[model samples]
Target: MFVSVGVRFEANVEALNMVETAGNYSKHRRVPYIIEEKNVLKIIYVPAVSGESLAHAFQELLAEEAISEKQKVCRKCLRGEFLKSMDEENAAEKFDGGKLPSDAEKLEEGIVKNCTVEDIGGFLYAGKPPVKRTSAFQVSYALPIKKIAIYSTVEPQLHARHAVMTEAGKKTGGEREGAAEQMIYYVETGTAIYGFTFNLDLRAIGLSAITGKPIIPEDELRARRRAAVKSLARMLSSTQFGAKLSRFLPLGGIVSLAVSVTEKPFTLTSPIYEGFEDMTLKRLEKIAKEFNEQYQYYVLGRNGLETPEHVMTQLIQYLKERNTL
Candidate 1:
């Protein structure tokens, strides 16, 4: 049996969690195992035992701390440039000569306003002129599976779940169903972390250098990973911000209607100021709202309204029919 699949990096986190659980896995033999940064694979020439053993092996793999730790950093390293930038500023001589970060690093100048938690939002992203996304913001979204396709033994629809199962079986084959099984489980919750890096000094220098201020050094590096993490959990699995965004940001265009908006900037526009907040996540509560509306409007037409699900169904079918979606 050869089951092949490609999962998002975030999904891999849960895989580790699942494999760590002893009862989630069962290893019957020494099957070949291959684990890649973004891919996992397994092939067995045995009977039903192969399937069961693979499942357990995956669980054990998920339980490992190294796997989880790597997953945590995946979000931070999406842009190798950004990570390098942060590291550079961390060692710059500008630290002793520059000023210290007041609240943030990228948006160090962003005054710690008197605004309440209700007033906090992620950074805004405005595209270059002519596009007119005045209120559009940015979000560093690691879309784990942007285009998932499988060309192997089973149906395409079965690839996702079977991928993890196949990887697990190779780790544990004949082990009894107890601690061994718990080790076979992986994080199957489909949750990914969404948050912006709080960079102040480095961003300032990259776009508009903020000269070293007196006693307050500017070269020192700091990040708002903690703040972003705190804000991220407020959403439902990092995709649904629920109703919390309505207060800080209105729901109208794409910018206002997002469900889980991040502060990842897409570009610098005319109205954009060369400052820190330029890339900081200003409002993240409303994500993809505008995209959904536009999709529905274009697909279903303004004369009639269709539920997102219905519109999406039609869109998928059309894509499959034309092989474009």
Candidate 2:
């Protein structure tokens, strides 16, 4: 089973994913978006969130869900530092003194069995042969929809910090002398309708990428798969997967969502383009008939469609009926 989700959301005054702090100003991540106007091509810089940020949030939720279900999660991943088994020595740390097999296949198996997050999220072990496992899931950088890309804005928000000064410091005239009483800073906040895509390959969960085989038991695989799916559903529904949330939580929920579930790997039309929902439905229909495969699609924010949670539930049910879960 394969699942693809495309989301379009509105975010106002959000400093969710920042690049760096230069002096007292924090910059929001920005990317160049290209568009055509009057038979001419133009490029504009827009505030965006990197795929790394979204992946990190998803893994954190996956770790929490796996732990909640009593599934194995490496110590590092449990603490949200996903440095998964960098080498033989590092792999041993995850096992608490237990040495990992030297063979690449065995090493991959051991890591997959030990950490659900690593199994699903993948890792690269720079050992003798440098084993690598591709992540079962993929995420696209959250960007403003193309039609609204020109209107997207990143503006600086001013903030300050005040310090209590001693009587001597006050007498010397605060910062000019020796003591600074107040500090002003700016954080770049963004406002736009952002779109991103997420794809999950259910067949890859609990499977050894090195040997192309199932590395864990059937029941355990099912459990890990459940955790992986649930993590995504929870992340989207709560809209809690970004940085600087305490101070600059985006003032928006999901404005639109489109999901496609299929027997074979398939990705929906990216939501960054307008009319992506209609395009996705039409493509799904064409592919299903041409390939003679089964698929299901769900949408929200059009014609009073289903909610994200409901769509996920339907996907879970689809997997169960096929015995993929």
**Whose TM-score is greatest here?**
2
The digit string of per-residue lDDT tens for model 1 on 1-325 reads 0001111121211111111223433221222222233475543221011222322222222122212322222222222111211322321222335333332333322211111110112122121111110111122222222122111011111111222234456566633433343432322222222111211111221121223332122221111212222222222123222111322221221111112111232221111122212221232112235433111111122224243233334433432343221
Off by over 4 Å in 2: 94-96, 166-179, 302-306
Model 2's lDDT to the true fold?
0.88
Residue range with the least summed lDDT across 10 consecutive positions in model 1: 128-137
Model 1: how far is 289 from its true place, Å? 44
Best by lDDT: 2
In the range 172-288, model 2's lDDT, one tens digit per residue, is 665664324478899999999999999999999998886778998899888898899889989998888889999898998788898899888999999999899999999999999
Error of 2 at 216 (Å): 0.6
Clashes of 1: 80
Each prediction's Cα lDDT score?
0.22, 0.88
